[model samples]
Target chain A: MAKQFKSLHPIKFYRDYLNQNVRPDGRLLSKFRPVIVNTGSIATADGSALVRIGKTTVICGIKAELAQPKAEKPKEGFLICNVDLPPLCSSKFRPGPPSDLAQVTTRFVADLILNSGCIHLRDLCILKEKLVWCLYADLICLDYDGCLIDACLLALLTALKTVKLPSVDYDVAIDKKVVNEDEKKSILIYNTPVSTTYAIFEDKIITDPTAEEEDLSSGLITIVVKEKELCSVHKPGGSPISEEKLYDCIQETIKRADLLNTLINTAISEQTH
Target chain B: MNVIDDNNLLMRKVNCKLDILSRPDGSVLLSQGDTVVIAGVYGPIEVKTQKMLINKASVETFYRPKSGTPGIGDRLYESIIQNICETSLVSALYPRSSIVVIIQEMQNYGGIISCAVNACCFALLNSGIDMKFLVASASCALDDKGVFHLDPDKLLSDKAKANFVFVFDNIAKRIIASHTSGSFNLAQYEEALELCKKACDAIFDFYKTKMKNEIANKV
Candidate 1:
């Protein structure tokens, strides 16, 4: 029966593959699945990107709106990022308010954006403390395989790079702001952050675990790196991992981040050309 | 009687791909011009006791906007899609069950409601559900000069005096649902309706070709 196969086959197949030091998809224990990124695809949003890691797909759309700058952060703008995991992606989630996993993922992604400091908030300010551009990045998962954090990070970064803001003009007599659509400018990105997730099962570390692997893993860790700097090391407490394992994960994350940086740069250039 | 500087007006070409997502029971990504919609169909599986109906299946639809939280505007589209699906699908075959259709907006240059309706039909077809007849929808906009344009883009739709989205069943070529925005006189509304009915023919042809090609590729 389909039910029996669904529950038994993945466990047995994964265990056999692990014993052989490989994955069910025929990759080494530390090998990651392929990632693909497409930028500026959505017409409604000012900027958008679609990212796919293995079978996991995520779409990030960035909409720009104008609002008053916070008095405390007079020269700075704001960035709002939300991650939505609807039931269309997988059967694990139902339709309603975001589930616990979604909330956790959303917080992690928001923290990653703040800690990475890839974007300069000051640049979004049109008239300091008066009017500022508010960028809202809405990332929706269309498929749930595994490694959602990595896909979201990649999509968000690419979508930001594709954003083009219209020039604003302040009319003194009219006392109103006018947006000039003919001349547009792109946002400056200071750093490009990429995240890598690993699942630990039976003293083995698996990179880019699938949905099934995630459920079976004893612990999960996500390492975020931007160039040589470490932004965040997220381990939400399932099983304690040793320092040596953590170090190994960080090193792997650095290598992956470097590759992703180059990938994103190439995509940006390809679009511009 | 038409008045306007002429030519260079054509409907944006529509492109579609079926079964793009693996997790959904039925899925489709459909784009008309620059507007794109992704639809997923799941159902005839299980239903809660409260929602279950003894005589027929319960149908539900959720429409998500491109970004931000879904608001009252999206609910309007959801109801339209639900009604069209209820009309086309043979729910009597699966009683006490539920069928869910989730539509995600990818882009919206114009004709968004029609695009969503078309995508839902494709998703339903991909799911292999029992349907009394295949359905297709088209939107026609009438400009200030009384000229009817088929599949108008956002620029035209914004300036149009009136626009209407018509959903038609393939069997009798009768309109199953019609949604109108802006204002038009009786004669203008009838002209737009006739234009959309004729446009549906081309859309139906597109559906046939796409299915035929898919079947050919499979074998």
Candidate 2:
């Protein structure tokens, strides 16, 4: 369910804020809140991460299991992403199946995964036609103050960076002379796909829509990007956007992606030690 | 959970490694794939009596989401702790007093409430607050594919049976509070109790290490 928050209706504030473009939060439209990323924060899973963007908080975890490959993608393993916004997070959501928002988010994640090159499909394949690793990327929003896409991206990136697939262990062991039984190491991560969402309202393109802004938004475009490359894009509304606005969005995303990736990479690195 | 997660078997449950936090009186970070949850505990300080003395120490729980904000889960947590806290703690002895149980959720992949209980137990003990018999573990309904997953992360949790209600403390050991959903067959109920026992034992090991190091760190 969409959040039921209303804009503060700061008409004067907007005019002044837009002139110099200083947000009430003391940030430019392109500037995001202080971001924090932490990985290995969830012990029960193979890998986990939490990302907080200002007031928005998102958590993502990766679970890889042995499964059969798809009919077409038999050589490479498959990945599934599911997003959940529980009723507890907001009264708007009731306890039930995946909502429309979740479905969209899931699709967004799949696009991002493909576009960002976060995981190597080859490494996920355990054996040619025998075994494969089906990684389940589950994203959960504990709170939705605003800028959910950015927070989700932050969480997803860190979770991917910190995930470790256990080494394959053989049941056979030699007595006198040690033997090998096709042992394998951890799964390899290729690149990072960061999702950047921009909410448009009243001819203004807000980089990271807060709760109020999201409520009053005309439409939003969430783009998934890899290093200096566009991976996927999710624009829900049918609103006709300008080429300038689209290009502007990408430019802001490039800068934002760099910052996000750095934050997540550094956090994951710290947890390793 | 079986009713849920049926569509995508890949989106099922997995074994959880409970207990992972340095601070807090107790901590447990549970995960189900990409859904992560870090639960921390703090408190058992002085409380008010006659605030409705029920011949037991009152248990007060505060749940803070990852963003340091309060949402609807806070209500569920407050009531859950209130319902189970008395039975979990030596409430009768400290009547008119209070035991503050604060749970901070760092990330919630799914089945977080159960993980919260597990964290609460560890946190209460981590705080070195005396309690009654050990409070067992808790987990939600398992997923489809006949997989009785331990902790249903967000994906599995959202699809659980209506009455799946989240079993806590286990039957074989001791139960602080559990939904009287009355849906589970006798055998299934018994199995859940056993599962909690195993989960409890495993989590306690982590708690032991956390408490030892936390106490030592102070020194």
Candidate 3:
């Protein structure tokens, strides 16, 4: 039937392209789409950035607010990363609550950020247990093609860089806290983490897979690399891949991290200037 | 060429595919100006006693974001879609039942809410559900310079002075639901309303072509 052909045609086309060591979009297996980043675009948020990877777009806004420190981590501040893949992003998600996909991605990015040691919690602490900066990094996907984690991480890092935290002083005279909006300080980021996603179609690995490619692929592997170190290698419940393939992905991710870091640095400098 | 003509963002074609999934009673994958959505409808099914309506079918809409679970902002979209569905459907015909619309987002450039509504409308029609009239939705945005645009892109939508999402019933061309954000004056609001209403004509035509193509494919 035509319906069967309709579904199978794309898979066959991808297979044909894979056989030639090329993609339908005319990119190599390790090539990534052109990435674009714009920082401090959202005036309302303390820090914000819009990041785009090919057709996929992610906007991240960081809202820093004062809050009581946790009883256990009294001396440490908190960073809550919430990644939103709204119905605006793609047809894969329904409109209502966060889907399982969103939660998984959020947890993955949160872990990546934490494991990368990009933002130190102790640096956010102010006045011991009395006051601390609660950084809320909200990453919203406006367009979804693929490589969402990569886009989200880039946006979060850029937005975090753009953040200007106001100086806070406790007024002993009136038992109040006076926030100095004029004196703003940016947070220190130790390392830059960039994620590279690959879709394993049979023996071939497709970099930055489109939504269609992802759906057709047998497995998915996401690698997060910071500097030259592998921060996280997330391959959850997919077709079996060889150890060599895994190592190759990591190497590709490392190379990609370097390229993306330059892009991020250039974007940050453009915004700062 | 002029700047307005070069920015053919609104002139892009819309693609719609129906009955893509087997599980749902009706399903549609709608793509407009890079904004893609998949809508599924399961209706006239049994409803839980606690959530059932005695006189009319209970309408439940579940909107799934691409990444995270639904939050407060999603609730607003759900409510808007719920209102539009409630007004369009003759729910009394299927008492003590439930009609669930599940919409999935793919790519969003702009005019998301309007696109979602349109997808839901098509899915409902595909489901062969009884309706008082067909519904079409369009969005209009007033940029910082006070220029009016139909189905504005992300950049314009982000910096626009005001934006409006309007749903219209096919019968009397009356407004079924209107959702607006940001700020605008009375004249601007009226201008946006008139512009959106005009934009709906093209949207309705797009729907007709989609429906015809879907029917032809089935045959």
Candidate 4:
């Protein structure tokens, strides 16, 4: 229930919040939750991380395996993201199967990483198309208080930072054409991206909303960035946002991006130690 | 000739929990060494007419085991989970309504049931009984190459000969629901049950730890 049962009454609460430029959480036009990031939580995974934004907690694990590449992208390695929300995270989520919500969100995250060039695709290449590294980044919600989009992004980044692939030897199987673990490959990484989310409740533009605020919101704006440029923006719902607000959101996200970039680096540094 | 030692492969797991979730009747996470499982119980709520049976409160259960999405989004599989839950639960006491239990396997490897059943028991206990007994556990197992292993990991799961899932009531010491795939021989079936017992006994230790943690935290 990301939307509060306030209407069918008047104007949408989220729209009104955006209009006033005051978020329900009492922040300015732009703000992010107090967040923390860590890594190596799942030692079994090649890379793993746990991220917390306020109360929203997400765990992301990355596993690398050898697989054949597609004919079209034979030179590039494989990347797959499965974003899961177990029912325990929220009362609204039902148990059983993947929801339409999960599918759309996963696409948004994947595109964000793909376009941002967070991973060095060439590093995953092995033996032309016969074998390559298949990276599976699995995101699980431990506690979804709100602003899950942002928390998920943070977790993804943290997991990517810690993920180290086994060293690859293309000549390991010169005759048999099989890659073996006689040696492991160095970790392959490119740049990293951070995602920020905003919820509109009336005129107030709330940043990193709590679950209650999320339900009250009419619409939300998610922004993913790398250094200075924007990687992606995902908006899902009936309510529409204006270009002016979107720009403000972007400008505001710039400031948050710097902070987020710093945090990610610090977390990654701690993880390596 | 070098072979991997079964003892060194890490065989067991445990969890410490308190009342974690706010809305559930009760909840717990059971980990069999990173094969993580979370189970929650909610209900005795008023049931929709179509869902209600004239006699007893229909039990609804949902399972999502990190493999891949199964047939439907929980609506279809809820019945299977509910049946597994009801077999050991005192559903008769909460008649004409519904008791919904949800199980999620987050980090799946193998022997998912061994952990799932344990989590389910902890959640049921937390849901505030209507219990006929103290606890119940369930496990899905397989045996290959005549080696009777308890709680196989993902690597072993791929090579297993049969898939056996059993639900048991700890109070009655009875096997409530035992299901076996066609691959195993009669002797294998007997051996798997014996292994299932070992798995169940291990999971019960997890159940106790969760209870103690919950009690200490008063969560």
Steric collisions counted per model: 0, 20, 24, 30
Model 4, CA-based lDDT: 0.66
CA lDDT, every prediction?
Answer: 0.82, 0.60, 0.80, 0.66
Docking class of predicted structure 1: incorrect
State the displacement of the C-alpha of residue B5, model 1, in Å, after optimal TM-score superposition: 87
Shift of residue B38 alpha carbon in model 2, Å: 49
DockQ, Cα level, model 1: 0.01
Report residue A260 deviation for candidate 4 (angstroms): 0.9
> What's model 4's TM-score?
0.51
| Predicted candidate 1 versus true structure: per-residue lDDT over A140-236, tens digit per residue | 9999999988999999999999999999987546769889988989999988888898987877889999998998785577777777766655554
Candidate 2 TM-score, true structure as reference: 0.50
Q: What tens-digit string does per-residue lDDT give for candidate 3 at B1-219?
A: 111343522434567888899999999998877889999999989999987988899988888877788765565577667767876789999999999999898887888888899999999999999987888888877787878877777887887766677777766665555555544444565666677666777777777877888778879
Residue A93 in candidate 3, Cα distance off native in Å: 1.3
lDDT of 2 by residue, A1-273 (tens): 112221344454454565676665677877767778888878877678988877778888888777767777777887777778998777767888766456555555565566455677877875566567787878899988776766776787678667776654322233132223244244667777776777776667777777766765645666666777655444432223554566577677777778777877789779978
Regions more than 4 Å wrong, model 4? A1-30, A170-186, B1-219
Interface RMSD of each: 25.6, 22.7, 22.3, 23.0
Which candidate has the highest TM-score of all? Answer: 3
